[model samples]
Target: MKMNNVIFIMGVSGCGKTTIGKLLSEELSLPFFDADDFHSVANIKKMSEGKPLNDTDREGWLKIINKLAIDQSLKKGCVIACSALKEHYRFILSTKLETNAKWVYLSGSFEDVYNQISERKNHFMPSELLQSQFEILEVPANAIEVSITNSPLEIIKIIKKQYMKSEFGLFGLGVMGKSLTRNLANNGFKISMFNRHVAGVSENVAVNFKNEHDELSNTLAFDNIEAFVNSLQTPRKIMLMVNAGKVTDYVIEDLLPYLSEGDTLIDGGNSNYKKTKERSAYLKSKNIYFIGTGVSGGEEGALKGPSIMPGGSKETYESIAPFLNAIAAKDKNNLPCCTYIGPDGSGHFVKMVHNGIEYAEMQLLAEVYVILKELGNIPDEIADILESWKASASSYLLEITIDILRKKEGDDWLVNKIMDKAGNKGTGNWTTIATAELGVSSSLIASALFARYTSFYKEERVQLNKLYDKQTQTPKITVAEVFETYQFARIVNHYQGIKLIAEASKAFEWHINLSEMARIWTNGCIIRSTFMEELVEILKETDNILTNSVIVDQTKSLKPSANKVIAQCALAELPIVCMSESVNFFNGLTTADSSANIIQAQRDYFGSHTYQRLDDESGAFYHTEWINE
Candidate 1:
């Protein structure tokens, strides 16, 4: 009963494609589709007139077929008889179908196909046009090649015999890996799950997972790396969900021996972007495709749907887009939260910035919580207030914070019992480093990361508090003022984060579509929100968020409250690192005339560096001395 979700009976005209496809569909109890039925009237006319259609002509037709295949892939498998002649045409037809699509090429001599077409009574494809198809035919090497001379029944039998391999392969059966595997299986993609057998650690990890999920009849599990690789269909798509660094490399090295030239390897970890670039180049030399994809949302998101950011060769991305999209979270418009970011490492870089923004957002929430606590509101009341802000400022982070604040263990607040120290898993650090390296302004992200580092010195902070006799008067800040401050800081956080991404795109020639990135972040990501939905529109208007009228008006209205909160927090001896930096970054960015002239003068006086003169029409550079040595 093992079968591809989409069986494409492909060949030039008059190759028994329809005959074989219909027979196969009946045998598999699947629906059948003819590519000709979906063609536009203009296309039919062009072909009927014996004129060959160009790539541009077939582009829309191919996309329509691809969409049909993707839709059918989520339901019962379908059999499609298509003249998927050129390699690029086949690629387009299989866009979202990925490994779930299998090709059955009807092979025959040109003369034989021509004779069969000449004998046909009624068909839109004329025998005269058959020669053009043959001329454009880029035969697929990975198809189940059956001679057109064979009976339809015999060809179906051969196809059934060869289509037993799983649609996709997943290596690493840890938390994220296992969740993704189940997600793929649930989406009707036959998947092979693999995990190295480590005694006492992960013995029979994949095998046990398969046994536990008996309903996942489409899956095969293996502790043997060779067996796992062999279980996948050709142009094998294997995603590595292991740890980012040495573990990912070691697993890749082990799998390399078994992988072929056309196979693709995906890293679904928070690996450093530079490392991703290195691995991508290395794999390209080996003739293997490497994709560095960022899978956001935690365990629940993985099992349900996560926002997927995949970057690699555009061609390579097409081979795996369907499988990723099928398991990606849907936005309000029901579009998958996945897109082809760009070439090598860009996905990871976007994800790194995403995590950095996540840090700032989380710290913003924490600061709000502390301010509320200082103003004499308990955890429960604070949670309710935050819950009320959902209509305007709702986000995944905010939702989770509300739950965490409301959580109690035996009448004692669990959050209160927890330590004040915060922990980060390197992505936030990587974000700050990338921002600095790219010379982008990311003070909010940097301040958030530094706050975490400072929190690590819990003992030092406690000791210093006593030495300084740390005490604070309650800040005269209303909930409305605090909420406004939160809104303003969040707007600035997103602006800075997007700016960093925009700068990196310019510096590295990534050419990332900020609008698409915003769309993907509208769901399944930690920073997803109503604000992201608005941002999706704003980014489409301009790259600089501050310039948008919506952002400008909102910031203008919220600026007074943000200023008051910062001033009062400082006077009350309370720390608001991320919020303070957010306001400061905004102030610095908006300043038309800056005091940097003094710094430039100081540098010129000491180091003899040149400075550009604002008064000079020709933009002349000059250096001056101040004090006589």
Candidate 2:
């Protein structure tokens, strides 16, 4: 009842704005201001003489009312009666009070409004000019619409009910879902949460979450599908945080029947981009809105703020932008780390590439840990050394690696006690396959994925270790060289991942902005880093990172360090799969005259495949027998 919202009752003249505004004003215990009182004497005189005010005439009056609304919004808030007939007029009145303003549209037929105006006593807006007001009325898409046929008291009740409906609905109660819901509620959004109740497992999950977070008074939880759907306002926005793949499909089918036209559904899981595109089409066929948003930063980020990538209809995106932006992480410049990706599936595709880069980055760091360990550096010493690089090479991966190294179980290093095998959740595999399909090389990401697959052979590795003894010698590499190699390898890894995304964006006609991707990743995602911050600026000039002069100069300086690290690791019988592949990929990519000519000749000799000659600047192909009998 004590809501801090600047409520505006808008409609054509004689639509009961003043009548309901006064009743609601008393109900909410807020000051009521009529727009007529703020109008200039000349404006009232013109209107009284049966002439309507033009846009220019009303501009200053709207500004005066907006100033009053702004001041009241900062205080307890107020109710205002205004004929905000045009969309721009509403926009002018609500400027600087976006989040705190709520609109109630008093809709009525011509006959109803005409009758009310005929009975009016001393209003300056004459009955003859009522038709002019209706002609210029631009109905709002983001307001609570109520019929003026209802009595003023009944109208007040409807307004209150619609105004108090939950602003957003989140339909999953898992770790990430719960965290995000709490984050929304913390940001002053009334949210409804729905988690289906199973017989034994997850029974009353939604209810229990609400009970546990008793401090979040703006949240509601439900186990019934219809009840949950009905709890939201019109054109409801619901985000699903369930598992990707079939489980996501199942949840969509379950909610489809309850969703109305114009309602928006967001898949906030790690769903495949292809699936997201299909879902977008499927939902569009039914007049429902769908957005495939890629949310990163894991559980902690969900509780605080994660980077958000939403792609679907840009129109529908605007309807939910306020809520998404409120809960998204901020970059160095204090901009929200959420943006509209090109269209359906682009957001998920970006997230998939993010995970691919994550795989390579983690592998690169792990290789650094092994090389440092082989160089007789203890866990604590390595942690300190890596922590010292935060000024220039800070990253979420490096920060966590430092924590992981220094974490001890009593007197022993805990990381040593953990299993060597790494697990993947299919995104890296998808990235590798996509690169091959797109004819783009992402060797660093592939090597990282292969390293995880190879680590799964625990028994085979044990037997091989015994059968073929590695006469391993300690590498004569300094910690500084290893750090430099790590930096160079990370640059190559990011380049490869982004190149894959750029290729896909071209192939799919997504028209994605590569620089914006870097900007968003600069803060909340796992791959966020000081390097990503640099990339935000670097990519603005050129989409190809290799073509950028600064990166090229840095690569020139760091290539020798990478080569030295790889050479010593190879001689010492150490495996640096991702780092070594990064250098190899770079070399292959930069080479203009590759040995593929020999490959072409071999293919032609065996399969009679024709070859193009280097001298053939003209468009021509040639074939000749090397051995003439």
Separate clash counts for every candidate: 0, 0
Provide the overall lDDT of each model, using Cα atoms, as 2-decimal numbers: 0.90, 0.90
Q: How many backbone clashes does candidate 1 have?
A: 0
TM-score of 1: 0.88
The C-alpha TM-scores of every prediction are: 0.88, 0.91
Q: Give the per-residue Cα lDDT of candidate 1 at 565.
A: 97
Alpha carbon lDDT at 374, candidate 2: 94
On residues 358-411, what C-alpha lDDT tens digit does candidate 2 reach at each position? 999999999999999999989999999999999889999999999999999999
lDDT score, candidate 2, position 331: 93
RMSD of 1: 4.2
The parts of candidate 2 lying over 4 Å away from their true place are 1-3, 11-16, 39-64, 82-98, 106-141, 147-154, 601-613, 617-629
